[model samples]
Target: MTDAPLGRSAAFKVLTTGYVGSTGPGVAATVSYLTDAGRHLIFDPGMVASPEAILAPLAALGLGPEDVTDVVLSHHHPDNTMNVGLFPRALVHDHKVEYRGDQWKNRDAEGYELTPSLRLIRTPGHSPEDITLLAGTPTGVVAFAGDLWWHSAGPADDPVAPDRDQLRASRERVLAAATLIVPGHGAPFTPDATTPR
Candidate 1:
């Protein structure tokens, strides 16, 4: 299938795609929809290498760029935030300490509250200011772990982690808080279940 299955629950909903082989360096757009109090919000707009590739899949699902009220980035890497500039009208949110190389765009460092049920958590370690979207989903609270662990890259790669200690600590924190995880490059999984060690 060109797109991954999108699901919803009482608290929030998500169309998790882009964790495919065709998108940006093997990354694609993963869009989360949080509906509360008559308001709609978006989380982790997806990795942006081929701009149209990212937007096309999301658009086919009836979620357009103009509909985005806020773009919550899991991290500052190009794969995650490259096409962020596409949303001209939305407020962009990121961790205060994020390291942006050459790509530039409008963003906020302070943690944001799109609504009480949805927010950004500073789950750094993968990057200086990497953040994960902590929101209520079908299975449970899901953390969109960005590069915290590379599921397919194998144990020897350690998923290209720069800091071993921080990675472990980040994993633990995410594990403690989120029952479901939408990892950066894999299908959503349960952390409590046995994961690749």
Candidate 2:
């Protein structure tokens, strides 16, 4: 993979696309953006796509991987981090705790600044290495909350629920910091987004 410069200011755009899966119509992947000193930085690149899958949408935006300076993964799950190698020149970011031995030598989680407008928070629970990207965008402080809390399930279903105290703390952190939330596998939620029934 090649490393690119992270944008100094942050900006974001969402790309909604289909992912073939068993969960009925699968959820859309939320791709966040940051303007690194005028360049573009993409948060997570979902499952690998064929050349055709990448062309149309990207062309619509007039962007290609070369235009993407970095990719910050929220965790190591294949669904979230599978396309890390595709951007042959973009640097990959993730949390240190999520490193699975040597499988990810090029990934970094030490928390690099994506842009003056963005910050990365390590919010482990659903997975020990899960991290959320926090940014102050024009809308509000938006949290790219990767699987830390899923809109589809209540906190009770979180894999870390057995540790109620930790889960509660994690939830509180998200609620307190997020005025807007972008969850890993569901619709974007307003400040009132909460665990569903």
Candidate 3:
């Protein structure tokens, strides 16, 4: 899982930064855009105020839904997969399957490489089906970790996690593997001493 920084390689952009209100009002999933090996990918096209919140940014990047070759769901949670159908032409990926045009293909997500620079790995914690998308970009390894971390400010532990121990271990693996992490509901962050394990 080590990669030297390349002069030109995969790249990623935050399409919409999400938020979790302290009082349970404001919320959305952080949608992301990634480009690797001529593939346009969307990560977690989930709950948002509107589809435009996600689409406008992609449009700004000169991409339409049809241009999205793939969409990766970090988990089956509504917040992480609600708007998956927006990308009509994309092959949707879950932890254990790939869906496209009414056909479901079974596959293992653990270490599944979508491209030389984009890979998927199971990191169940926030949910048993949770997975993470790791992108080897020119900058460094960027992990689109779902609620394995809700945000940079670790709740220390996920309050709703079925198994806190598994959550902790998953966090450790993500921390060890990614130099930058795009959490489920926050801006991208560089893990530091303050980051929870």
Candidate 4:
């Protein structure tokens, strides 16, 4: 994927890089820009996109791998987690249910959060451990929907979800919580963009 914009949140401008065929599927990746004055967060660095393809966007924003302070994966899928090693110095956040060791679950007892600005919505549909990242942007809330729903799917479905009910609830919550979403497999789009008029 190319470096598409995902709007800005506070001192950072978020961007994305499309799948580069580094793996079987081309899952879109997310990158963020932040100086020491801002929190540098990278969500879903992508699986198939080449290292250069993924990092170049950040480079364009004057951010190096080490500059990233946080790496949050929506799930354990290689598409979202494989490239994490690229940011060795970053603190990784994820639902522990998806990994074996040294992982973290919902920051709260309810498996979700809406504190301050960054909200981690525990959306267990595509995977039981998936969590969507919602950041308060200047435009509005931007959701980093990691496999919450494939971009190709219509408003009514998330075909890969193991639990249909959970996926439905998750979608509803995301639709309500975010104005824009950077999906795991497709381009960034607005919830209203996919809604039926």
Taken over the whole model, the C-alpha lDDT of each candidate is: 0.59, 0.59, 0.89, 0.63
Quote each prediction's TM-score. Answer: 0.71, 0.73, 0.95, 0.76
The whole-model C-alpha lDDT of candidate 1 against the native structure comes to: 0.59
Q: Put down candidate 1 lDDT per residue, 39-58, tens digits, no spaces.
A: 54566666645666556755
For 1-197, candidate 3 gives per-residue lDDT tens digits of 43322323789999999888867976899999999889999999999999999999999999999999999999988988889989999999989999999899999999888887888888988899999998988778898998888889966878879998999988888888789999999899999999987
Clashes of 1: 1
Candidate 2, 69-161: lDDT as tens digits: 667788777666656565666756788532232545544443545565666766676777777777666656677777665553543466533
Predicted candidate 1, C-alpha RMSD: 7.2
In candidate 2, the residue pairs with backbone N, CA or C atoms under 3 Å apart (3 or more residues apart, or in different chains) clash, namely: 2-88, 2-89, 7-35, 7-36, 7-37, 8-36, 8-37, 94-109
**Ranked candidates (lDDT, high to low):** 3, 4, 2, 1
Question: What would you estimate as the lDDT of candidate 2?
Answer: 0.59
lDDT, residue 132, candidate 1 = 73
lDDT of 4: 0.63
lDDT (Cα, tens digit) per residue for candidate 4, span 57-91: 78888888888877778888776777878887776
State which candidate, 1 or 4, has the greater TM-score.
4
Residue 163 displacement (Å), model 4: 0.5
TM-score leaderboard ranking:
3, 4, 2, 1
